[model samples]
Target: MEIMHAVDFRTQLTSIMETLAKTAVVEIGKLFEENSSFLKLEITRCTRENESLQQKCRLLESELQAARKTAGKINRTEASLSHGSTGCICVDICTPTRLDTGNCKLYITNTLHACFPDTAHRPAIDNVFGKDWCLNLWRHEESNAAPNEDTNLSSSGVTVEPVNLLEEEPDMIMIKEEAFEKCSSDKTEEDQNKRLRGAIQKQVKEILPELDLKKLQNVVNHLVYVVGVEKIDDLTFVEVTDLKDFLEPIQCRKLVKTLKQKDFFQESNEQDETPTEITLTPLSSIESIPEQPFFPYCPANSEWLQRFQIPWDRMPPALTQATATGQRARPGARREFVRIVVAAMQAICPNPNLAACREVARWIVSTYPLTFGDITEEGEQLGNGYSCLQRQLKTRVEHVNRDIMEHRIRRPRKGLATKRGADEESYVGKKFRNCKADSYGCVNWQPSSIPEGETPNSLEMKRKVAAEIFQSAGPRAVELTNVDDLMQQTYVYQRHMINSCPPPSISEIELSWPFLFTERGLCRHFKTLTGIDIKSRFGETLNAKAKRILNYFNSQRLRWNEEIQSLLSEIDSDSDGTDNNKTAISAILLMMKYFKEKETSIFISADATSTKMSIEKEMTLPATPRLIMLGNSLLTSSKWFISIEGRVSHSIDSQLDFAAALAVFFGCFYVFNIEYEESAIATLELIQRFFVRINTEGTKCTSKSGTSRKTGSAVQRKSQNFHPRVATFMQRLSEFEWKTSN
Candidate 1:
C-alpha cells in the first residue's frame, strides 16, 4: 500500500512538471513572435524614412542645378543686352532646352510687343515660326535691317507714308543747308520771311499799347533769336517803323531818321498845308530837341511860375530853418513847410483870413533865415522872451483890473453897516473860496471848513483846518481812502496812511484796489506783530516782499478754488444725483491715505531690494503676455512666503518708521506706473534718436572720409551682407514667423 501511494505521487508530480514546461514554451514563443513583429515594423519605418531623405536630396540637387542654369542664363542675357547684340531680347529668353517650346513662343510675342510698337513683320514671323523661333528671327532681322522706307511698316492695315518715315530720321544736314540758302535768296523765301516779320511786328504793336515805354524799349532792345542786327537793317521801311514804335519813344525817334536815311523810305518835299503822307524820322532828330520848361499858373493870384519855384512866403518854418542852416531839408519838414506856406499865402490873398497859429509858426520857420547858431541860442531866447511877454500881458491884465477896482471903488450904498466894498453881499455870496489860512486865530473855525477871501488870515486858516482834519481822522479812515481823494484834499498824512497799508492779495483783492495792503505795511507789521524782520532775513525790498506774499496767496487761492470747482462740477454732473460731494471728498482722502501708505512701503522695499539684482532683472522683463504669467506667479509667491517686520523703541521712532515705509510704498507705486511708462517711452526715443544720429553721422563720415582704406573693408562687408537673395530669404523667414505667430 505504501509503494502504490508513492508511485501515484511520483506520477502526479511528473504531470505537474510537464504542464509547467508547456506553459513556459507557449509564453516564450509568444514573446519571440511579438519581438519579430516589432522588428519588422521598425525596419519598414527606417526604409521609408531613407527613401524620403533620398528623394529630398535629389530634389535639392535638381533645384541647385536649376539655379546654376538660371544664373548662367541671366549672366549671358545681361552680357548680350549690354553689348547690344541681336540675339534674344532678355524678356523672351528662357532655359536653353525650353527655347523651342510654346511657352518660349508666347514669351517672344510678349517681348516683341513690348520693344517695337510698329514692327509689322511680328505677326508674319509669329505665323511662320513658333514664338521662340520668331524671337530669334526677329533678333536676326533687327541686326540686318535698318529702319527705312522699304522696311515692313505698320501692322494695323494703315499704310505708313514713306515721306513721313523719311522725315522722322535725324540725318537732315544736306536738306537743312539747301533750305537755308533758299530762304536767304529766293523771292518765296523772302516773302515768307517778310510775312513772319510782319506778323511779329503786328503782334508787338498790339501788345505794345498795353506796355509802358520802358518795358517796350526793353523788349525791342532784346536780341532777336532768329535774325542778327545786320538782318534787322534789311527790313522794309514800314517794318522798321513798327520796330521803332516798339522801342522807347526816345530810342524810336533816334532810330527813325537813321532808318529813313538808309533808303528804306521815299521822302516827299511838297510844302502842302495838308500832308498826304506820314513820314517816320530817326529818334536822334526828336531826341536832339531841347526839353521844354514846365510852367504852373495860379489864376486867383494871377501868377505864372516855373516848376519847383513856389513863392518864398509859402514855405514851412522847419524847411526855412534847414535852408538857412545850410542843411538838407527833411522830407516831412519840407512837406509841412509847403502846407503852411500855401495856407499863409491863401490867407494873405484877396480872400483874407487869419492864418492858423500853427500855420503861422510853420511859415515863420520856413521863411526865416534861422541858422544852426541862431537856432541854438536865439531860438531858445525867443521862446523865453515870448513866454515872458505872455506873463507880462497877464500881469498887465491883473494890474488893469486892480487899478480899475481901486480907482473906481464901489460907492458907499445908503444904510450900509460897514465899508460897502468890504462887507458887500456880492463877495459874501460868491462861490470862489480860498482854503488858505494865516497865523491869525479864527473864531468860526473847524477842521472840515473851507476858508473864504484871499487874505493871509484866510490862507493860514485853510492850512490849519487841513492839518486838524488829518489829525482828527485816524490811520484806518485814511488807509481806506482813495489816492484821488487824498490828492484832492492835499492831505499828506492820508497819503502816508494809504501807502502804509499792506499790498492786496492778487486773487482776493478787487481789480479796482490793488494797493490796499501795501508792501511797506507788511514790512512794518512783520516787525511789529511777529517781531521778525522778513525783509532783513530774506534780503527783500518792501515792494518785492509784498509781491511775493501776494503771489503766494494768489497761488494758494487759485489752487483751492480750482479744487473746489472741480469737486462741485463732478458732484453736479453725477447722473445718480447722489450727494457725491462727501463721496468725492472721501475718495480723495482715501487716495491720499493709500498713496501715503504705499509710498512708505515702497521706500522700505526699494531699500531692501537695492542689492537684489535678481529682483531688478525680473522687473526689467518685457510686459508681454508670457512674462505676465511669470510675474503673477512671482507676485503670489512673494505675498505668500515673504514677511516684513518693524520694531520701534519710542513714539518718535515709530513715526519715523511709518514715514519711511510710506515713502517706500509711494516710490514703488510710482516706479510701477508713472515712472515705468515714462521710462519705456524715453528709452525708445533715446534708441531711435541714437540710431538716427548714428546713421546720419555714419553717412556724413563716409562722404567726408572719401574712398579710403579705412572704409573699404566695412563697405565691402556691408555690400556682401546686403545681397538681394540673402535679404529676400531673411524677409521671407520673417514673414513666415509673423504669419505663424498670428
Candidate 2:
C-alpha cells in the first residue's frame, strides 16, 4: 500500500508540472497579441494628430505671409510720402484724382510760380518734378486717402500729416526755459554766503571733531584771510557780494601793517612829530656796532666801592699793591687777563668777547685800590716797580672795552689751526704686533704639543698645539688626514667658528694665501666646497690684495726711486716744451692710435681752432670741452672712457686704472672681432687677475743682455709655453679696419 501510494503521488506531481508549463505558454501568447493591438491604436492616433497639426501650421504660415505683405506695402507707402513731402516727386495723369494722385507736382508747380512771379505765366507741374516724382506723389496720395489703412496715422478720421509727425521740438528753447526756471528758484547771494559758511563749519566739525564753534570760526576766518576774497569765491560753492563788508577795519589795518613790516616795503613811523616820508635802507649800507675801543680809562675816585665789590677781601699783599695803583709788572698783563676771562666767557656764551672786556674793566676799576701810593708794606714793595705798568694796562683795557661798546672799532676773529697729525698713542711699543687679538688668540699663534713639565719650543709650537686641540673637536676632523689636509680643514673650520662665534674679531684667522685670501677666491671656494655663493666676501678679497700690494709697493726702495726719476723726467719735459699745445695734441693722437690698434672703441676729440693762441695758453684745455667730448664719444661708441686725463693728470685711484685697462681691451674686441670666440679668453684672463693666486716667488729667467733675445739653445730648451690664444688673436686684430657707410 505504501509503494502504490508513492507511485500515485509521483504521477500527480508530473501531471501538475505539465499543466503549469502549458498555462504559462498560453498566457505569454495572449500578452503578445494585446500589446500588438495597443501599438496599432497608438500609431493611428499619432498619425491623426500629426495631420491636424499640419493644417494649423499651414494656416499660421498663410497669416504670416499676409502680414509681411501688408507691412511691405505700408513701408513703400511711407517712403513715397517722405519723398513727396521733400518736393522731389512728379506724376502725370489725365484727370486729377485723390486716389494715387501726385500731390508733389501741384506743390512744385505752385512753388515755381511763387519763386518767379514775373517769369512765364504758368509752369507745368512735371517741369518741377518729372515722371519718377509723379509716381512717388501718387503713392503718397493713395496712402493719405486711405486714412484707416495708414499704420502711422492716428485713430481719428483725419489723416496725420507726415511733416507734423516727424517734426522735432527745438531743444535750445526748452533748455533756455529750464535754465530760467532754475535761476528763479536759486538762493540769493546773501543766503548762499550764509550756507557756504555753514558748510565750512560742518566740514570743519567733521574733520576736527573735537574743536569748538569759536575755534572753528577763528580757523575759517584765517583761511578766508589767507585765500583772498576772489580766490575764496572761486574755490567755494557760494556767491559773493561786497567782500569788503566781510572784513573788519582792525584786521585790514593789521594786514597792511604786516605788509609794511616786510623788508621790501617802506614803513612810516606814526610816532614822529613831523610826518616823515617812508624810505627803504640799503642792506649793504646798514651799519653794525664795532666791538673794539680806541681809548680806555680807569677811575681813581672809586677805590672804596671797588674794595667792597671784590669777592676776595684779604688778598695777598703783592696782589693788593698791584691792584692799588692798577699796575702790573708784566707787559700786556691786563690784556692777558682779559683774554683768559674772554675765553671762559666764550665757554658759557658763544659771543662774549665784548662782554668780557667791559665787565672785567669795570670790576677792576671799581673794586681795586686806585691811588698809586695807597699800598701796604708788602704791596708797597711790589707797587714801586709795577705802578706805571699797571696804570698803562688798565688804561688800555678800558679803552678797548669802551671802543667795543661804542662801535668805534671792529672785533677781529681768532684763527683756527688745522689738526693734521692727530693720533691716539698705544701703551705698547709700535712693534707690539699690530694683530688685532681680542678674547680669541691671534690666528698666527697655532698650538703645538709640549712636554707636561716643559715650556713650548717657540710661538710656532704653541700655535700647532692649539690647532691640534681645535681640530680634534672641530667639524672637519674626519677629513683632516695630514698636515696639509689639517691646514686646509682648519681654515674652513676656523672660518665657520669665526662666523658662528659671537662678536668676531679682525684677527680670528690669518688669511695670508694670495688667491685663497681674496673675497672672490673665498666665494669661489665656498661655492665649490659647500655649493653656496655670497656677495659680502668681495671686500674681503679686495682688502686682502690691497694690503699685499701696498706692502710690496712701500718696501721696494729701488722701484720707488725709479718711479720718482720717471715722474721728474716727465715733469721736466712738460715744463721745457716750446709748443706744449702741439705736444699735448700729439700725445692724444698717440693714445688714440694705441687704443685703436688694440681694437678699443674710444675716440679722441679736440676743439676746432678759431684763433692762433700761444702754445702755453692753448695747452690748458678747458675741462668743459673735454667732458663734452667724453660724453659724445661714449654715446657714439656705446662704450665709456674709464680713465680720462688732459695729458697731465694721472688716475686718482688704482681701481680707475684697472677699469680703464679692462674697458680698453673689451672695446677693442667688440670693434674688431666678427667672431667673438677669443672674447671669452680675454675676459677670463682679466677676471683671473681679480681672483687668481700668483706665485710671486716663482723663479724668473732673464737674459744677461738689456734686451731679451730668443736664442736657438733657449728655444730648444723650452719645455712648456703658455702663451694665451687671446694675446695672439689680439695681435692679429691690429691690422683690421672698421668700415663705415658713406
Candidate 3:
C-alpha cells in the first residue's frame, strides 16, 4: 500500500510541470509579434517627418531666390537683404500672404514720385526723401530678435514659429503704427503759426480786411525760424524783441493775447481737420538763403575782389530781362520761314532720310567734344542738351497719348493761345478747366520768331526793323492782356506768317469748328468745293440764296447738297437733275453733323502745345482712315460715309481734327477725279507738321469702315461662355460685315 501511494504523487507532479512550459512558450510568441508591429509604425512616422522637413526647406529656398530678384530692383537696397527671407517674415501689407513679386517696388516708387516730383530732377534717389519721412517706412523687422546668420535654418536653435496665415499677431506684424513720419516737429509749429495768423486775420477783418494774410504769415514763419519754438507761449524775451521788428508792440501784444485766449498752445481734441503734413516745398531758413554757403566761393567774386581786375566782357546792349514765366526770345521770322527753316528740321526721324540725318551737333554742344565728336541724326545720337530736350518732348508726347486713350474727349489743360480767344467760355463750365489767374498773363503768341542775322542784306534789314518795332513796344507787349490791342498784334504776327505763301485763287475761306453751325458753313463749303464765289450772272450778291439752301439742308431732305436737294424736289414733280459738286458739299455736311453727335467723338485737345500740337491732335483718332469707293465714282465723296451707333466713320478723318488724314483723303479724291491743285501741296506742308502712327498691325478696328480682311478660311468655332448681357452687346457692336466691306 505505501509503494502505490508514492508512484501516484510522482505522476501528478510531472503533469503540472508540462502544462506550465506550454503556457510560457505561447506568451513569448505573442510578445514578439507586438514588438515587430511597433517597430514598422515607428519607421513610417520618422520617414514622413523627414519628407515634411525637406519640403519646408525647398519652400524657404525658392522664396529667398524670389526676394533676392526683387531686391535687385531700385529702392530695395533700403531694406536688409538678409532679413528678406528668414526667421524675419515679411508680410506685404498691400497684399498680405501673397508674394509681392514686383508690385512692392512699383508701388513704393510711384508713391515717392507723387510725393517729390523734384526726385525726377535729382541725380540721387536718396535725395528724394524728406528728412522728416522715414526711409524704412515700408519695412519692419523683429525688433527684439537679432537676425541669425544660419543659412541652413534647420541647424539654428532659433525655431521659426509657424505663423497664422489668415490673421496677423501683434509681434509678428512688421509695420508699426509710427512707420511713416509725414512732417518734422518744426513744420507742425510753422503750420500752427499759420493757422493762428489766419484766425487773427479773420477776427481783425471787420476793421482791417485789407490786411495781407500771406505777408503776415511770412513774418511769423521767419520769426518761428529765428525763435526755434513750436508753442507760441514758449517764445523767449529774445524772440519777442525780434518779433517787434516787424510787428508793433501793441500788435504783438494783441496777437499773443488772442492766441492765449484761444488756448492755441494746447490744441483741442475736437479739431477734425486732416493733418496738414505736406506743403509745396516750403523753404526752411537755410534753403531760403540766396547763396549756398555764408559766402560763396566763385570766379565772379574773385574778379570783383581784385583791384586791377580786367573789365568783364559783357554784351554791348542787354537783349532781354529774365522773366519768370517760360517764354523763348522772339527770334525774327523770315519770308520763307515756313518753307525753309521750320519745315527743314524734323523732330523725329523713324526711318532715316540721309539728307535729314546730317549732324545737329553744331546746334548742341558736347562735353569733352574732342574725344566725343559730332553725332549725327543718322547714328541716332544726342548731345546733353539735345538728349534733355528729346526726353522732355517724349514725356509730353506720352502724356498726350495717355490722355487720348483714357479721356477720349478733351484734356484738362487748354492751349495757351487759341482756347482763350475762341471758346474760353466752354472751359468756364467745367470743374478743373476754369482758367487760372496767373495762366492768363502776357499774350505770348506762338509763331514768335527772332530774326537770324545770317542774311545782313535786304532780308536782315526788314527783320531788324520789325524787331526794333517789337522792342520799342516791349513794355506794351507785357502790359497788354486780352485787350482789343492784342488782336492787332496777333494780326501783325499773322502777316509775318502769310507773306511767303501766296493766297489761293480758289476763294479760300477758313472756318473754325464752331463756325460750322452758322450760315457761313454752307457758303464756305460751296466756295471751297467749286472754287467759285456766291455771285449771280448780274454780279448781284446771292448770299440770301445760300441761306435758303442751308435751311433746306438742315431739314435733312437735301442729303447731298442744295443742288441735289433741288433736283430731288424737282423729281418729286417729275423733273430730275443732280450736280457732282453738290454731292461733295452734302458729303461734307453729313460728315460734320455725324461727327458733332458722336458718342465717342475725337476732339481737338485744347491742350495741344505749340511744338507738339500736330502729334497731340493726330493721336486723338483711334484708327487711321481708309479710302472707300461708293457708286464706283472713284472719288471718296462725302456719300462714302455712313453712321454706326450714331457715330460717323469717315467724319473723324475728313474733319480738320487730323491734318494728315484730311490731306490723304482729299489728295486721293482729287487724283481719283483727274485734277491737280496747288492746295494739295500746301496741305502736304500741313501734313508734314504732324507725327502720325501708321497702323501696320493688320488688326483692324471693329468701328472702322473699309478695312481689308482675310477670307477663304471656313472656321466654325466652338461657342464661348460669355455673360448674357456682354454677349448681346458684342453681337450688336460686331455687326460690321456690311459696313466694313472695302
Pick the TM-score winner: 3
- Per-residue lDDT of 713 in model 2: 33
Q: Which parts of model 3 have CA positions greater than 4 angstroms off?
A: 1-174, 180-197, 200-210, 232-240, 248-742
What is the lDDT, from 0 to 100, of the residue 113 in candidate 2? 57
What TM-score would every model get versus the actual structure? 0.12, 0.13, 0.15
Q: What is the C-alpha RMSD of each candidate to the true structure, in Å?
A: 49.8, 49.8, 41.1
Candidate 2, run of 10 with poorest lDDT: 694-703
Q: Choose 1 or 2, whichever is better by TM-score.
A: 2
lDDT values of the candidates? 0.32, 0.33, 0.31
- Rank order (by lDDT, best first): 2, 1, 3
- lDDT-better candidate, 1 vs 3: 1
Sequence-dependent TM-score of model 3: 0.15
Cα lDDT of model 3 overall? 0.31
RMSD of 1: 49.8
lDDT of 2 at 270: 30
Give one digit per residue, the lDDT tens place, for model 1 in 1-742.
9999999999999999999999999989966654453355357546645644565566667768977986786565445334433433334222222234465546656765664444532222223343354456446544544454243333334332221211232133113455467546555543544444333333343433323333333333222321222233333243334543234332343243334343322221132222223222222211111212322222332332112233565566776666644543443564454454444344343222112222223223333323211121101112111121122222333343454555334345565666676768568766753322210111111122222334445444544453454456532333444432432343222222223335222222212222222232323332322223433433322223223222332333444444444544554454544322223222322222212222121111222222234433444422210111111212111111011112110111122222222122212111111111221222212111111110100110011111222333222212110112212322233334434445
How many pairs in model 3 have backbone atoms within 3 A of each other, for residues 3 or more apart or on separate chains, i.e. clashes? Answer: 10
Residue 376 lDDT, candidate 3, scale 0-100: 21
Q: Score residue 541 of candidate 3 by CA lDDT.
A: 16
